[model samples]
Target chain A: MKSIKEINQKIREGNICVVTASEMKDLVSELGVEKAAKEVDVVTTGTFGAMCSSGVFMNFGHSDPPIRMQRVWLNDVEAYTGIAAVDAYLGVTQLSEKSEEYGGAHVIEELVRGKEVTLRAISKGTDCYPRKEIVTEISLEDINQAEMVNPRNAYQRYKAATNSSNQILRTYMGTLLPNFGNVSFAGCGEISPLNNDPDYRTIGVGTRIFLCGAKGYVIGEGSQHCPPYGTLMVKGNLKEMKPEFMRAAVFPGYGVTMYVGIGIPIPVLDAEMAKATAIRDEEIWTEIIDFGVARRERPVIKRVNYAELKSGKVEINGEEVRVSPLSSIYMAEKIMKELKRQIEAGEFFLSAPVERISKDCVLKPMRLKEVKLVRSVMTPAITVEPETSVEEASKIMIQKGINHIPVVKEGRLVGIITSWDVAKAVAMKKVGRVAEVMTRKVITTMPDEPVEIAARKMEKHDISALPVVDAKRRVVGMVTSEDLSKLLAR
Target chain B: MMLQLKFDPKTVKKPIISLATLEASALLNIIRASVGPREGELVVEVEEGKAEKVVEVLKSYGVEVHSIKKAVERDEEKCVHCGACISICPVEAIGFDDEKRVVVNTTKCIHCGSCVNVCPMKALALP
Candidate 1:
């Protein structure tokens, strides 16, 4: 069994201890106040009185305002030359002693002391005028003047303003100090309320409170703010705080700190540091998500049939088998069993046509190795000859269900005619014969040439087919798109 | 048209004197010590009208000047026929004659302690 101290230590180390104010209370109750105090270094009271009485000073006005003169002093002529150089070099002179005096030496002394003084100085052995002005205007009056009715109201306003300012400051700081290793903030009212502390006054709501890079008084309450009795110290790693605060502080122009107060009994500094670390870890996780580094879920497996497979063979999807009689028989049996299972499951529908799987999987497709054009193919060519009369050629073309024919003279290649040629001539109402309209310069290819080459030549010339001829220039066969389609289908 | 010559890291030569080895004063001393006086010789020269301006600029940048003069020459046969002055010529101006005698051309010489450092013959002297 663990000792009470060990158990308390374990609780403090766990992630749950850092979440909220109530959880911290529960932890303190379970572990006892002394152990809890040891676990959490900083505590926040929800009351404005506790926060203000605790001597936690916040500056809300602009920083580094223009310098101004408070008073002036003068010195003897001999002292002026000697002390002026030293005062000028040091950028300050003692003038409080001579503030009541109004004279040239006194003014010069004031100028040397960095007081707003108009005076003359010797330059290159000649006196020259030197003008200086001091602007002094930084005080509590610069703070927003909204009145608070009660401590709770003051605390709420302070928190709201601070949170809003922090949102902006976080963004700016993120860009300006990207490498700030860790960040933490500690105070009361924002995190908790004052309990039984009469000397402390409540912080007014919306009263400007400044902390680190975050500015503003207060905003809405968060779960982290509870059981207002102690100062709350927020801690987090820089990595975590960067994005959380950077978004508001840098890009969108808001002031906000990205730290969450860890309300454990550990040292305030340690708790703040731990918070920073936790924030950094959270930021790393966020980065991972943003970069799409998460693991994907598995896809559902679906059953497929032999006819649906793109390989032109039926086999188990991932199983490899040799092309042998026994293996083929075994595959057939397996397929039968798979089909039976589908049928028993009532998934196999006879009325619905099964779709073929994608053709992308096919390794190779069958094509025509050799084409033998017999009398049937030759007759189509003969009907569209150019020498034949247009009427005769049209009659033959209509009867043969062919559109083009080779025009041969003395059994030698000459020209070709087409139904389109006769139709065009008729449309123009020309009296010319078929020979006049037939194309004389014929495009031809060899029978041995590849089908693809013939197709490319036809496409290049924008013609339908190329007449395939032998070495003796005798027309042997003709290759067309329809023939190529039939070949590809196989 | 303005032309800029950039000195990339790849091309700069090693300095004759390492900055780590000597202070600025010592370096200037070494440069000044390199020149020595010679009879009828002008050891250093500044362009006709630019001497004062050049000195001012150098001074502004903390450079020191030593003696200034014109050139001088030594006859090959004028010496005691000893080669003592050869090593004393700081700028490597002294050489040996065919008979192994010393010869000095003051124009190329900066009168430092080159021959003065180890002049066994003591045949040469500075004005």
Candidate 2:
């Protein structure tokens, strides 16, 4: 076993041996976990992908009149100004009203690149700060402090996204092709920081990390952070971050998100740490979630490992579908290499966590939900007397925008006629009572029936409409393909 | 211009696309297609100059035809070589070059717009 102090001493003397997570897999196999742990002083890991729960807190210097800013907009992208008078949080996903493609993430990237950004704010008048409005350009140097406080930066594991339905789905996981033609996964399997330290043994509060190529610290567990698939909330100096490690993205139908590059170094304290860092892509499994559902609970098409994901294709629905990584493996590799070099040069040192992150937590989704029923969806049946003329029945169907009209006798359904029957009657010039064109054997349903069963009955009967009747056979309402489709689409 | 052709059970087995490609004397780039022996839809693209001939062949088959546009544009200045769009492109229209920079192939582009949505730089656009 080794202490973090010993590892720091070795790093200072240029005597430490550092290997990236990708390289450590082979190192562990060749030397075994015990020897590899004794030989290697540190293992560096990284991940680069679109992290939506990211933003920057900026302290814009007070204007000449000293305004207590209540509303703020940077480059037309609104920032939350409820924090303080001169401080606001620019969330990465906040889109610009002027141009949706431009967003808060772009502003953060610009600031990191040393580019100037336009700042505008409005405030309610107050005696301590009477200024009402202020507008100016501010760069990284002009701001008092620009700190990046991302609520969720690194994910230990994540599900890949795919579409099995006929229509293309534009989602946060990127655009999924129809019929499961493509799959996109975001987690960097072997070289990922959280994957290397699946358990929070070395990564926790106050643990230094590489955030967007800046020296940063893990502040706490992320918002959706949970056991078995932990995530981290990190903080860093925005001005010290590099543009290459940060980027702005817009997922078309989905809103804006920032691509964050995060790297963590693990000290080789014991053989367990070495074995954990050596975990290969083959052992890492993630679900291929069907994004086509467009719901809180998406269907899982299948489970696949990163090895199959990186090989370019995976078997989905008994067919080979191409797989892609929305997470930039290229950038992740570069970040890992940079972190390793920093440790080797003694420019970066590993630190013990001030406090370990909580492990007893589970992500809970919003509980508000609704289940549709046939009674609520069905419309009141439009009826016509059996002795009514065919032309009159057709006119009622046209005026009400309905295809089927139930012919009634004494306020009870006796038969049904559709637009097709009316057209046939007109084409044949068989002008007579509605009863002549109507079919007597009506397929009936009950109001309390589940929508699913009602829909299945229609499909099974190969019919478009069903009349809802009470116990005494009085027509109450009607359910049609149009109504069910409208409800399903929602 | 792009043309969508419906292939019914009778026409699905016929070589309609190949015939159109040969007689039109132009490359009819199939943008999107899902034709089965049962029945399906096929969307094809051709040079505007040769669209008339392609439309003529499609009409001769007595199939439904409609024009559509699904073109994706790339802005080189905004791209940072982050490679976010490389894997999401359904047609592999976007790929890495020798130096690991992303390159787009216009001919192979299916106009699916998958890459445009995944691009972190907003470098790719479906206009």
Candidate 3:
């Protein structure tokens, strides 16, 4: 078995052999894994796709007077200023306050393209740094530090997406057509960095990589990183990145995301490593998730191999649905080829990890104790007895300038009276007590329920209002479609 | 000779393309489309002699039609030949050449803007 040290020595002497992961497959098949492992020094792997959890950290270098900025913005897109005085982290998907398309990803792309961007900041003046506001233009050359630190990149097993609902779904996975019209998926598959070393055998903290046209390194395990399978936290030099490899993209309905090209070299330490790099698209399977569920845990329709997906079609629900890849295999091949060239020329070398990723990465949902319930959006209920006359109910409706009134008996909702029922009663010439015109079997909601649940209930019943009640069924408040619509509009 | 047709959400269900073909007597060549239940966009080419007639027929049914000069401006220098736009075009207007560089068949392209939107490098843009 060859060690990374011996490979580096060979690389230094200009006698090392390197091949792309795709070519490695052919090499391993021709010359058995054991012999190929001895002949090849490194197998380069690459992937290019939209990575949303990506951002850049920049130190704009203190202003003339040195401002301790409380809020910072680049090209009208706000950057996270929770770090130091002048340092900020700009997330890729952070949208501009003024427009949907312009975002921090655009800012990163502009900086990489060597264009200048306006920088604005506002702060509560302190005695040591008495600057309230500052506005200036800055470029990559002007910033002292421009480092890309993506929390998650190069997913080992990416999921393909399709829609099962009747309406079109505009998601981060791209626009999904209604009724399983098309399938959209990402990942360069077999050549992908994490896919080549799924167990992180040779890849871990401090492993050198080709990160978006620059030499970069893996820092640690990223969020949602299912062990043995992979997702990596990577960092790279933003100034060295090329626009072709690291560009900003705005999916029509979704916000902006960055497309990153990442390549990793797998040193042929043994037959196992050689076999790992020889994995093919037909052998790798990804889940096809139905994105129409509108939930965190979407339903997985089937496990389909990348071979079928790349062939432009896959069977879904017993029908041939056209397949489209969001990831660019063309760019991935270029990255793999360029990396192979670099390794052969002895310009790049493989480095072992400083630390192995932790195996105990259990993803947990954020326990939001302050979650907004229906009570927060509901209006306090006004109630009347069933014995109340229709004329009095109509008078109360006009006085309150409201549409519906809930009728209660012994602190429990029995019926609901609307202005329409009053009009119908008048038209039918049957003016009587509230019970005669009121609608029983009211579709009620609970105060403790989430606002979305109430909204869905109203939509299902095709009604405008709902009575919010407690365990005793007493109407505590009222919620209407108007409140939900206003909240959505805001 | 290429024509782009846009159907709003209400008009998408109409059998406009077949009707236009029968009435105009033009065997339209579909180059690209991105139609959904909400709305639809189509790019088609008609014969030189019957191009004006097809446009007139489509317009009679309230279809927004445009005779395309060029679907988009392709910046060859910036394009990385990524296949992100390959199958995204309803019509196979964008395809890889022998060397795998994205070749835009301007004559057959419908200017649906799908490729232009998905190109991360910004190599494709509206003309």
Candidate 4:
């Protein structure tokens, strides 16, 4: 039995394998079908057909698609610390609802989670669409153990197999890229192995490439007709593949994939690898098209010639014209110059109306400032002296459109009478004077008191307005609901 | 299940261990323990007339007041000579003149340190 390390080493030395199908010209060109198929030991001629026929076959479902994974090593402590620093910079903290402020729960959670735990960061790709990158770190021991299980077993096997290959890619990329960010473990998919030689028994194992990052616009090209997992590669120049210049590469998949490296042992390797994959995925086998600069179109100008005028009629360039019913001939001449200017400035077109304003005229708009409150603005109250006859008081209420009255004696607020009091007196047929029906107990408020307090007191007592009084208990200014409303409106 | 066993006692560590083994949970527990409980307090200072209104508003919002102290005031005329106000006023609201007359600043006096009682000249009064 060969050790896992020996199997991986042998697989790395084997010949590259490729596959091609006659119907899939696009896929074949992308994978280098002829050359890859000839070098591999196991060449399945009908593999593509088998994949097409088995619409829902379990493992076969993903067999035909190219697979990639992002592998990260977590040996360095600085990588862990860097993740913590980023999280702090992002202001990820717990907020309290009661105090409406940041609290300790967030800090506690961070300390417990070892900071290097998988975190999702939103980033903009070459396509300008937001992509989520999973930043995390995993132990080598965990990777090795992952190989022994059924599903979990595959991760470890791939980790061990691709370690050396990734190291070579990482080193080569280091000298090639600038400001290479960190690399972390990302997702993996199945791809046709480069070499299927018997010596390459671990082809499936070592074939899994670590995804560093991606470049160009990745669009979902195949998603409309079928479930998309395949990518369409657009060919472009190497210079075009740079992070700044690259356009979006359409991936027929549902959404874009962003792989983030966290707690990675080789931070430079991770970032560089991601960049290379992005460029490769962007180019590979794309159709060529001319994308040239587009020119701005100039505005077209139309000429209108006005001729001699006669009363309401005007002649233009030997043609006599009656003034338009909607506009005067004199106005039309003024509008013509404006219309011409508007067209030259590209401000108005044939579909828009051209309007002319007098040069000397200026618009003065009005705005409201404050609302003033006064006694006349209120629902008025009847006024009378205590000596007045009941007949006179009732007549005063009818004439003044008031329901309540304050009875003054010797220039003092003595009592108040309302329409209800008069109605009660009339109903009882008490043929008497004003003092008999008047309620002597009256509520009054000072002018300096806040209007709100006066309003509250009136509401509590079920009255309309408070008769404002001076230190001598004489009526001065009257405050009512209308006054309060005016103050509030202001 | 097969109960058959082989006698190869190489003591090989299990390759696949649960994630619980890496102190992830232990570390989380430690963090939770370290957080303890929050101790939050807020202090607000208000003028005499507005203090009652502020207290009423705070009480409506369910805040409790631990204590209330009257702010200081000074008698402009009575404070004179001796420099007793300057020595006894804790907030330094009082100062002695070059002519040996004592001066009292009504604003800085907190009312808590009553220098008026200690004045030998009986020149200081607080309201």
Candidate 5:
């Protein structure tokens, strides 16, 4: 059994022995585990997924007149500035204060690419530190230390999830296609780091890893790391396990996301460690679960190996379902290759864990007590009488930022006038009143009707607005796409 | 003188396998064809006015044609220009227009769906 020192000696002598987990697996099969272990020096593992728990700690070196940052934002994503005068932690999934589409994850990616990011911070002025705020742009080079430490990442085994329900699910699993049209699995099953080192053997606190584009380490047992198999011995090949092996998690209003981490350990030990490294895609398994059920006991639709999932199609519940890898396998392979290159060039080396990851940590379910906040306000609809000129109706729409105005007569609804109808009239050069351009068949909703029903009616009729009407058919409020979105956001 | 065709392997095995041979025999000219795990993405060339016949033959063999275009097409109505598609694109096909709308450069796009898969809006699709 060759030790890690020997591996280093070989590297020093330019006889670096390293192989990817996949290659190591092949070697073990060809030369037997013991022999393969003797020859190989390191086995690299990798995973690239939406790790929500990922974040970076940065020490933005003191500004001219140092201000203890009370509030910090990196590209508009709030970062924790409570640590010190210049240090802050930015979570990957934190939505941008300016735009929901941009998040802390995007910021991390940009930093890795050496792109400049706008840094803005606000602080109460102190006698020692005079500046109250600072706005600047910084790149990775500008920060004293920009380190990524994900609380959890490359999961050992992840479940394939789909919505069996009719409603489309917007989840961290990506969008769950309606009616199980598509299934999303978030782990690089075979090639993943934790999947290969199933028992945590050499991977734990202090183990060095390639984090995002930087070097990071395992700090401790990640939050909610209750692996299906016990710490003693990871049982049967992943393929044969029942659906009970899978875990279903929900982040409440945020939708569901799996717990995972990407901490690839550099095995510095003997051949047994080498054998542990040689796990392949065919050996790892994950569950295909119907995530439609609200209970923790999600139904297992199938038990398939990662190989079958990697094939892009898998038969589950007697139907062939299209499988999409939420994790980027391409990025994972790129990481493995880069790690191999670093090792071969003696640019990077292995380090032992300071602590072993705890096996007993269980994920506690998130239970939010039911609290209701009633919104009693509804903006009254601005009505355009049927006799109003089309030009006048168009002016009203433009001013109100609204696309549709109810064409009412006296105290009752007559029709609806839309921006499209106005534009069509203008294009046709028809000089007429609202009645000439308005759609006579208007879909109206009662004031008590749920905003969802009104939204659906608008969608069904391909209209932009549904006028909220009273018992006498007089317009009271208007539910538009914007209103429905506000309701759904709650 | 090139065309890209998509086919499903689960349905049309014979027609897909015969494509390479058909190219050699001058039945069709091929640039590349990838019959991957999900579907077939082929770049081929057919004589003028004979493209319809080729599609017909492939369809008869049970291949579902996804798109028959010179390059990838992006539904402008669906795109939110969120920039999610920008990072994963192997080729710099999809980019922001001056108005900040994501526009696909049909010339550069290989229809890899690298952008399509990661698009949160589901705006990008294979062609």
Candidate 6:
């Protein structure tokens, strides 16, 4: 194999023509590995998707009367303040205290757009660092340096998700339409950078890359670095397998996200690396996972190539299912093209990895120190007599600002009335007492019951509210969808 | 001439706009009119020399007339063939070919632009 220095000299002499990882596959076949490796100078690899493990570190320079930040927040989203007095790490999943939907990702996006973010921090004044608390606004430009340093980023390939249960599941896999309506997968499929280079030889610490429209580098192999696999043929060591055999994974939570780092090796030294760069989608394979099952090992329904997945249809257990990709192949291509343009314009260059990643690393399952469920937020049930008039019940509902009202006879829930029932009764011109219109059969939940059980009951029955009843069947409190939402947001 | 006519339901509640007052001076033949709950779109054909007259008639019924254009287009440069546009297509116009590249069949496209709206890569376009 030619040395990295020799490859650089060839690149400097303009003796090599750069090719993308996807393009190199065809070139290798056409020119043969030896000749193509000699001709090609560099290969560009890229990926683009949401990666939750990603976070950025910024030095906001000291504010006036600079406080030692013990607890920090950006735009109401908490940031880890354990580093120094003025620096902080903003995680992607950190949610804003003001609104759960507005998280650190949104804050980062806002900062990237050059918008100012409010910084809030509380500290115990020290002799050296005396300020106790500081609240200020700052922008990315105002920071001394803002760089994203994620331990794990690009994964080689990932499994697609589908639901087998009759009920709809809200997961990190997006909303799995009930009964396998559509499957969601993420990755660049063919043009992805890591998919192009299955082995870690070329991608490791100190490798310059394009990260989120900015220049970055590969610090090391990401977390959960699984063994590299290749096709059925040419199986020897980690680097010998076909690109399709490479697989890496991360934990699945409410939803799954991937981080992508597009890197271009400055110079291609040999045909072996050239062939690796030439991997195709037809050769890359990933498994289909049935997320419906709640177990440590989710069942594998099928193993398909990227080509079939990209076609939008795959037959699993003899049924055709539609597919959706969470990864942005368009953005990946755009970055690749942009990187190429930068290289051609002499504005971008590549650097060799200073240190290699340890392939011997293994992913360990996360062990919870302790799991506990505390009950403190169930909304108290507002009751109405079964003999109450529909108009009076409606008035009570409107006045109390509650959608559901429990109809009790002798302190015991006999039925339930919803605003929808009142609206429908009025529209149908059926004037009667609350009992006449209220649902006689009420699904009640116990206050001590697990929140998930209540949630599942609501989902199964397609109901929004449930009355909490005691052992004597007396109405105690209520758990509506709103209450559950408030509980989950915490 | 082929035109795309959009009927706004907010302006007129009558399911059939033609049931209302019709000047009828313009002789335009509607090839197909897909009326949905919120709005309706029609592909109309008019006599070679009576295109302007037909537009006037359509406009009288609050139908916004538009030119026949590419409803779905694939930006070949950006497409990574992830198949995100396939499931969202109201019409199965966009699908994978034997070569596995996502291709748009313009003839079968209804111009609903569902694929364009769902394409994460912004590789699909409608005009």
Candidate RMSDs in order: 38.2, 9.0, 8.0, 37.3, 14.3, 9.8
Q: How do the residues B3-41 of candidate 3 rate in per-residue lDDT, one tens digit apiece?
A: 788999877999999999999998998877889998999
The residue pairs found clashing in candidate 3 are B31-B91, B32-B91
Model 3, A1-490: lDDT tens digits are: 9889999999999999999998999998999889998899899998888899999999989876778989999999999999899999999999999999888989998999999999999999888778889999999999999999999998876889999977666778877778997888888778888778766788999999999989999999887997534789999999988887876877776788888899999988999999998898898887899987765678999998888887778898789887767877788888999998888888898899999886655777777766667888999989988999999999999999889999999899999999999999999987999999899989888887778878877886799999998899989999989988988798
- What digit string (tens of lDDT, one per residue) describes model 6 on residues B30-86? 656677778887776655576776677667667788867565778775565656667
Q: What are the runs in model 3 whose C-alpha is more than 4 Å off?
A: A359-361, A368-479, A482-490, B1-88, B92-127
- The order by descending TM-score is 3, 2, 6, 5, 4, 1
Please name the candidate that would achieve the greatest lDDT relative to the true structure: 3
Error of 4 at B72 (Å): 42
User: Which is better, 4 or 6, measured by DockQ?
Assistant: 6
List candidate 2 segments past 4 Å from native: A369-377, A380-394, A398-490, B1-118, B124-127
Better of 3 and 4 by TM-score: 3
List DockQ, one per candidate, in order: 0.01, 0.32, 0.29, 0.01, 0.04, 0.24
By DockQ, the best candidate is 2
Better of 1 and 3 by lDDT: 3
For model 6, the stretches where C-alpha displacement exceeds 4 angstroms are A99-101, A167-170, A228-261, A294-296, A344-349, A368-490, B1-86, B89-127
TM-score of each: 0.19, 0.74, 0.76, 0.20, 0.60, 0.64
lDDT (10s digit) by residue, model 1, range B36-100: 22211112334445445444443443333334453333432222322323322445566544433
**Tens digits of lDDT, candidate 2, A1-490:** 9999999999899999999898999999999999999999899998988899999999998887899999999999999998879999999999998997889998998889899988999988799999998889999999999999999878887998899867666788877778887888878888888788878899999999999989999999998897657899999999899988898888776788899999999987999999999999999988889886645688998988988987767987678777767777777888989999999888999989999987776889887565667899899889998899998998999899999988889988899998999999999998699989899988777787677767867886689999988887889999998999999898
Considering the true interface contacts (CA pairs under 8 Å between chains A and B), give the fraction that model 4 also has.
Answer: 0.00
RMSD after Cα superposition, model 5: 14.3
- Tell me how far the alpha carbon of residue A211 in candidate 3 is from the true structure, in angstroms, after superposition: 1.2
Pairs of colliding residues, candidate 6: A25-A278, A50-A258, A171-A254, A172-A254, A172-A255, A229-A245
lDDT of 1: 0.32
Per-residue lDDT over A1-490 for candidate 1, one digit per residue giving the tens place of the 0 to 100 score: 2232443353345421222232344555466555554465322222111111111111222223221211222232111233222122111111223332222222222232334422222333212222233223322233222121111121221111011111112221121111211111112211222221111222222222222112223322222233221222221122111111111000112221111111111112332222321211111110000101111211212232211221212222343211100011111122223322332343321111122112121223346566443222322245244456877877777887667677776666677777788898898886366788888887876655555656656776788766666677667666665666565577
Worst 10 residues of 2 chain A by lDDT: A365-374
Residue by residue across A212-326, what tens digits does model 5's lDDT show? 4445566676655777421111111111111211111222224322222233645726666766777777787778888665346678888878888766667756787766666
Candidate 1, A349: how far from true, in Å?
A: 75
Report, to 2 decimal places, the DockQ of model 2.
Answer: 0.32
